[model samples]
Target: MAQITKAGLTFPIMNSGNRHGEVSGEPLPILMRYWRARRNPRDIPALPQTVRRATGLTQQDVAYLAGVSVRWYRQLENGVAADYSADLLDRVATALDLSPAERATLYLRAVGRPPTPYSPLQEDTAECWDQDLLQLFVDNQEPMPSYATDLSWNVVAHNLTLRRWFPWAAHGANLMRWVFLEPEARQHLVNWESDWARPFLGQLRYERAHHPANAALAQLERAILAGSQDARELWHRREVVEHSHGAVRRLRLPYHQGQEVTVRMVTVRPLRTVALCVNLLVECANPGGPSAS
Candidate 1:
């Protein structure tokens, strides 16, 4: 009688430990059957194209590093074919220079791990110096309610209680976004047709000339055109202004405050990477006040 056990065991007498422990050929057949099923590329998981965009690497580059053909990698990205062996998948992960989160995604897709969410880093990330510089403006209480802003004036951070005065401060959420898109800005602005809009339009043109390949800047330009016809016209004029400094503008607080405030705007280039504007809002000691030097 043949002994009943895993793998092919031909035996007349059942031995407890006949050969050194090793997987028998019987298990190999079953393993091959499961392996064949697992090798289908379409059945396995793969990282999304969005993930690739976030990682900032092209598929061709990733494939070359992974030692796989570019066509095969594209097929993997598209979930077209499955030949992802554990070892091969490991090579691919390393080639992509994946973060821990990204590596985990690939692992799950290859093996039977649960799907997890991965957040990719954006390219136009502001540096720590930018934050520090922005904070300096906020902490200095010259009663001048000072704040710093980025090119789009997203108000990455601000200390001014001016959030109360200029409702635009909130809209300053994204400087370029507010300038070109917001309807309230277009209607309520004192000089939407000329002064205020002109300089910003000029600065934007200068920025375009300097950074034509800058994706964030390009996206902003696109948004402006998409958001408003006026913005489109302003862009076409090609007015270019270097946002260094000049005269100040009087901004009225929203309907609630109704107080007209004189704000001196100064641009400081502490770093070459980011252009910063420090806005110092003037307050009055008397009813009709003179400007603070």
Candidate 2:
């Protein structure tokens, strides 16, 4: 019998008669050696055990929650089944209460690739704002850097003050993408780990959970995951947090001449509507200070 060991799991390969059909010859041994040479190890965790441990659920419980028979679920866990359909895997993911990262892992293990990202259904009642309303909002936020973003953090509009400050907060710029993918962001953000990366990613996770099927958001996530190793690591952590308001962040501006500026970030929703629009404002921490620039 031939065997393949990979990722801490061992798979036994069935042996049939040698193709050369020479018993007591070099052909059989050579074929076995060739099979052995093909074996490669991977670093992925064992899927069954990972799901079991993470969800803290029994096999029976998972089967029940997934709306599948216990025997089928057992076969899945034991890796005896040939393959599971994507829909079945999705059901199992829900049953296990998996996070987005965990669900991605499950799909990778079962299908040898991540599941296709879902695109949310478009609603007919999307809110509409006139240019005057938007302009008025921007005009009122003077001296302070302020911008408006849609639910997915796409900067729909911004004041000149914001452009003067970040320069990267251009129309259609995604806040998450800018923070995670832009090299300039790393230089400008003093506390990238705690102040910007964690909270921003946490808020992203929260939004993703709420709008998992948004195609544009999914594409942006894919881009971010591909662009930055730090973003990938933080994303897999699956830390979900509510959006923070009035948070203070330290920044190193190009014009600040080696002085770190402390700015208070304020996040607000212009209308009390889900997935409508949000506004971000940055103000100086110290009143009447040069940092306000």
Top-TM-score structure, candidate number: 2
lDDT of each: 0.51, 0.61
lDDT per residue, candidate 1, 1-293, as tens digits? Answer: 23334446332211112145322232222222232333322212132234323323455655654567988766555333354665455455544434455555554443434223321112334433447756765767544566666555556555547565555665537766666656667544445557567778788778778766554455456445544556666668878887736445555446536555555565565554554566565543322544222
**Residue pairs whose backbone atoms clash in candidate 2:** 119-213, 120-213
Q: Name the top lDDT candidate.
A: 2
Error of 2 at 116 (Å): 15
For candidate 1, which ten residues in a row score worst on lDDT? 114-123
* Cα distance off (Å), candidate 1, residue 165: 1.9
